[model samples]
Target: MTLPIVTAVDQAHAAPLRALIDGKAKPLGALGRLEDLAIQLGLIADGPPPTFERALLLVFAGDHGMTADGVSSYPASVTQAMVATFLAEKASANALAKAVRAELRVVDAGVDADLPAHPKLLDEKVRRGSRNAAVEPALTPEEVAEALERGVRIAREAAAEGFELLALGEMGIGNTASAALIMHRLAPAPLVECVGRGAGQDDEGLARKLAVLERAAARSAATDPLAVLAEFGGLEIAMMAGAVIGAASARIPVLVDGFIVSAAALAAIRIDPAVKDYCVFCHRSAERGHQRMLQSLEVEPFLDLGLRLGEGTGALLALPIMRAASRLLSDVASLDDVLNGRL
Candidate 1:
């Protein structure tokens, strides 16, 4: 199915947005990034800055074929285990979401194991797991399509449930490798530039990971991006791309988490550049490739916390800042009111 082409917020919306921010008692543009964020929020909401009442953090969990090459310090089984941890509210994503009062949705996008029935888990597995790209394609074209559709469906459902903002997260053990591959191919950069030491991999392991990605890149050199994603993209990445598109089409603000989510955003932008308008980079991750990805997208995140955790932690951390932006835009008194000296 053809995904909807997300349209940009109209220029007409800018005047009202600027009025909302500038009417505040603070000197014009005195709020700095907060003022800019208010404008972006108003544009995304297509009205006065919106109150983010309900937000959802969707964490797509999956496993990668590249794990077999000993690229990651953790085993492939950690993917399933982390899904359970997320369900148990023990994972960092869950903790951060809880701290921010954002609802969490854990999806089995393509976990290797049979996940036991759970109330919070959304079972939408596209495959048992991706194939090791070092040996062959990660997923078939059909599987990629299904994963993308699953993400769109989830985003629509979240919107229907009254979520004003959608936050993207992921939980696949070897996903960083897949992200590196995607970034290397999509960005105007080489594989070595996009590759990073993920999950504390030692120098030797990082070298092996790079070698596997180099081989995968060479084998898939002739393929287009969609074909390459089908051949090598992780289920979670494909789903996150779909969610970004869906959120953009729905005109809801999307808080991008970290490197993996940024990589997915890059893929979505490749499919449709308009999707970038709805996205807000939450932070600059500690991972080396994150800065390159950010530069390629031409987005400045709200924070640079030196964080590398990828489970929407950055997005959750930015929640307060977003709230502050909206509050300042809507609640601050006008300079005219202050100057009248009515009191």
Candidate 2:
């Protein structure tokens, strides 16, 4: 399937926009990254500070067949249970979204169980779960295409619904293993460096997870974006990548949540380099491989709070920072205005 065309964010207004920010009633660069964020928000909107009256956080949940390999401390059932928690507004993502005044939507990209219908749930399952990557491809090419297409569709729908910012999150048991494998494939990092204590794995469990992922990475050595995703990517990761592309296509800024989301963002960039221009790395995750992924992208995140939880919480926490950035652009008086008034 042909992906949506996403052009680079326009920097034509950079000079005037920067001047507006610099003229704000504060020391030059006193606000630091917030000022930079305002400039980027302006460029993405292609004008004045973009309206973030409504922010949408998409939590894509799926399961990985590799969970059977003992990669996670919890069972695969936790993935669906967490969806229930999200629906009940008990998950961290739900609370943070409420605190930030953003709408939280859950998508069943490829969970292995049948979930109850809910108003907040988007039932867009591509499959029950992905195939095991240690012995075979995680997904067929067709499944990967469907996940990407669904993600693009979901993101476009959110943009149409007036959500100015889209944040990406995911839930899946053993998905960290899948993410590590993808990072290993995409980055030249060692397999051990890509591995981590996913879901609080013990040292022995971590070693086992590492060995599994290392073997999987060696078996599926193709570096092509689609091929790697099919071989090592989870369903939710694939969809999030597609969503990043979709958000860029619609000219909406995307706030990527954490490590898993960052890995998906990398895949999206590999698919289309222009997608990078529209993404805001929301935070630096405490997950082991996340900083490596961020460095490979060569982008600085807005916050780093040692966040390892995945549910879009990190992105939600950064919402106030985003708003503060825009507030400076919209509310703060310019230095010239202040001086003229005094005269």
Candidate 3:
């Protein structure tokens, strides 16, 4: 199936943006990455003074069949439990989102447990959970397609509500195993090299996790993006990829979260190369394979806080920095004007 055509972020204003920044009273590029961020937001807005009046964080929660393979420290039940935490505003991402003043919404993508309805929760469950990727395909093609469409629809809905900035996040037990296998498939990295200590795995658990991922990778060696997703990705990951695509098509900047979100970004990029232009990787995850994924994308993240939490906490943490970029670009005075006694 043809993915949605995303509009490439317009770089027509790059020179003027640099001029605008350089003319500021501060030293040239003194603000460092923040300045680059300002320029990027300007580019995404296609001109000066980008407005980030409303930012929305979507946390997609799912369950992985690989959890049965002794991969994660936690059980699949934790996925639904954390969804409750998100609704209660008791999770790290909740506090972080509040601190950044961005609204957070949780989506039940494919959690195995039954989650009650809530105002803060969106019901878009594609299935009870994905199948065991180590033994079989994670999801059938039809299921994967539905999950992707769910993500695209969510993104478009957020955009329609006047949200200009978006953040992607996920919650799924054993998702790292699925992510590792997906990375192995798409990045074609050594399967062992792709494995990481997900949610605090022990040495033996990590080894077992690695073995499970290897079998999953070998079982699903498809190169096509959707095929890879169906072969090894969770419902949350597939939806996030679609959300990235939908956000790009809507010309909204997406603050990509940690390892799982970045993996989803890679899938989206594979679908449409222009998606990269619309993304700002929030941070480099402490997860082992994240740096490799970022390297493959040829993109540098905004922060490296050694964050391994996967509830969009890293992305929300970067929101203020993004806002500061816009604030400085729109409000900072030029040296020329200051010299003319207009200060």
Top candidate, metric lDDT: 2
Question: Which residue pairs show collisions in model 2?
Answer: none
Candidates 1 and 2, the one with greater TM-score: 2
The TM-score of candidate 2 is: 0.97
Q: Order of all candidates by TM-score, from best down to worst?
A: 2, 3, 1
Off by over 4 Å in 2: none
Cα deviation of 202, candidate 1, in Å: 0.8
Ranking the candidates on lDDT from highest down gives 2, 3, 1
| lDDT (tens digit, per residue) of candidate 2 on 25-61 | 7789898778888988888888876658799999999
Model 1 Cα RMSD, 1 decimal: 1.4
Error of 3 at 39 (Å): 1.2
* TM of each candidate vs. truth: 0.96, 0.97, 0.97
Whole-model lDDT, model 1: 0.86
Query: How do the residues 214-329 of candidate 1 rate in per-residue lDDT, one tens digit apiece?
Result: 88887777335577677777999999988998988888889999999998888888878888888999999998789989998888998998898788999999988888887776
In model 2, what is the error at residue 210, expressed in angstroms?
0.3
**Local accuracy by lDDT, each model:** 0.86, 0.89, 0.88
